[model samples]
Target: MKSILFYLPTVGSHDQVLKGMSGVNRQNYRNMLWQLTEQARAADELGYWGLSFTEHHFHVEGFEVSNNPIMLGLYLAMQTKEIRVGQMANVLPFHNPLRLAEDLAMLDHMTRGRTFVGIARGFQKRWAEIMGQPFGVGGTLSDAGANDRRNRALFEEHWEILKKAWTTETFSHSGAQWTIPPKGLEFPYDAVRSFGRGLDENGVVQEVGIAPKPYQHPHPPVFQPFSFSEDTFRFCAREGVVPILMNTDDRIVSRLMDLYREEAAAAGHGELRRGERIGVMKDVLVARDADEAHHWAARGGGFVFENWFGPMGFTESLRRVGETGPIGADYRTLVERGLEWVGTPDDINRKIEKLVTQHDPEYLLQCQYSGLIPHDVQMRSLELWATEIAPNWL
Candidate 1:
């Protein structure tokens, strides 16, 4: 299985209690960046397949402070050679499609075609509200019965435009959410002829294409960060994008994979490729003994539940996605449901083997840092995972 190191670039000292949406200290922020760079380099040296970063905004609690994962990817890319760098997801609604296209193309070029793209419609209502997007899932935030379809529509529209921008020499778009080449406005087709040149027979000006095509042919591999909806699974299968499974039971994951394979076959993509088609993310904590591992897991998981999920209203978000079991459950319940793997090296190894055998995922992404887990403890877990567990899969 391919192993990936997933990072949130959390910015707060280990001793600092998570009080929910707290402010960030500049020194801590700098230190976090440096440490993340160091850890990423270590992962690269240790034969990791990729290093993925999360993107979040306006979280003062430092739960997830990597606001610009593309920038972080670039930073890590400069320091490493072998490991692929990517975003766990770039929230679609929060960005300008043209700018994102340009940035992604640039990143692919900068990384020598080692950049990957993950797309999401986003989940946090606060992020949408702050960005002046239509908050909520199905409709505007003010709409009481809103669901996620509206945001999904926006995400689809933006994604279509981005793909066009990347592939077409000159493109124009007229869609529900965006209008490219501005209506009723025109520019000179030829750069040299500034005054008057290259107008259409109807005196209409042509749209200019975005420059610097991506280093990868057509584009880099696109990923869907979390797969929960059947529509999303079909979309990924049809478009050749991989879906990353997150915080779901093994049965659900298997079902989703089966659906994806069926869709791909229907779409004439042929047999699904192994070791490159699907990814699974799990929270992992490895210690010398089960007691130490469980201790830290409980503390970290509680912090994630109370501060991260509770404050961010992610429990409700999960409900919207039809994941109801672990919404309000305690950390132990979550562990039992396979959302977390916490124990000694042998214990984690056994759990990993079972997951791999059952799901047949191509990539295994470990979320090793979260909540109030100290930097030292997190590093130790990484060290143990890389040394003791990762080799078995290889």
Candidate 2:
């Protein structure tokens, strides 16, 4: 299985984050970038498939501080060699499709076909709502809410435009959310006559093209950060976008995989094999022993889930089988649910082996906390995972 390091990108320690400090501190930001670069460099040398960070904003709370993943990815891309760098996603509704299209195309060119893109519907109301105002979208977490529909509308439209920008020579878009070249706007279409293609018979500013088209022919590969819905699965199946499974529940994940395969075949992707073009993400922490693993997990991944994901209602994926009330309410539930693995290297290997045998996923995103988990501990986990566990799958 190919592996991607899904970094949380927090900007400080668990103590600093709990105190609502360090995220906005200039020095911390600087140090975070350098330290992240080192991590990327190491992952590259260690034979990782890719490394991704989330696109978050307004994190004065010292958690989820990755602001613009394209920029952050560009910086990291310049610093590392083999391992691809990109966002687990940039929230689609928050961006202008043209600008995002151009930025990503440039990134693909710079990375020399080493970049990948992830798209999200966005669930954070704090920044997502404010940023999505232009597109008439609101933040949502459910699959069928009004906000969810709006976000998906814009999400699909933006991706359509991005692909067009990369694959089509010159394209014009007239969509519900945006119109290319805008309406009633005059251009230099007639001024220079040297411009290769710009106007139609009616001279209506026919189309606009993004410069520095992607280095990869069709485009850089695309991914969906998380998936749990039928609509999302079908959409990914049709669009050829790989959806990373978010939940570890056997019933849930297995059912979703079956749905994806059926939909892919129905969508003319042919009889896709089990575990083809799919991914699974899990929170993992490997240490010298079970005690050491739990110690760091409690201070890092578990801390974030308890203090942040729990109240934010982002922990449903970790809900225990046939159990309810306060999902992922504590660290113990997190471990019990198998949502995050914290154990010795041998224990981790066993769990990973079981996971692979059960799921057979092509991509495995091993999530290791950053910022809150000390750099040394994170590196050790990476080393152990790459050395002991990764080879089994490879």
Tens digit of lDDT per residue, candidate 1, span 23-89?
3777767777778877777778777888888777787777778889999999989999888999888
**How many clashing pairs does model 1 include?**
6
How many pairs of residues collide in model 2? Answer: 0
Kindly provide the TM-score of model 2 when superposed on the true structure, using C-alpha atoms: 0.95
* Inter-residue clash pairs, candidate 1: 22-60, 22-61, 137-147, 137-148, 138-147, 138-148
Measured on C-alpha atoms, candidate 2 has an lDDT of 0.83
Global lDDT of each candidate:
0.74, 0.83
Task: Give the TM-score comparing model 1 with the true structure, all chains together.
Answer: 0.88
Instruction: List TM-score per model, in order.
Output: 0.88, 0.95
Q: List the residue pairs that clash in candidate 2.
A: none
Instruction: In angstroms, give how far residue 327 of model 2 lies from its true place.
Output: 2.3
Model 1, runs deviating above 4 Å: 19-22, 134-147, 192-203, 273-276, 310-327
True lDDT of residue 19, candidate 1: 45
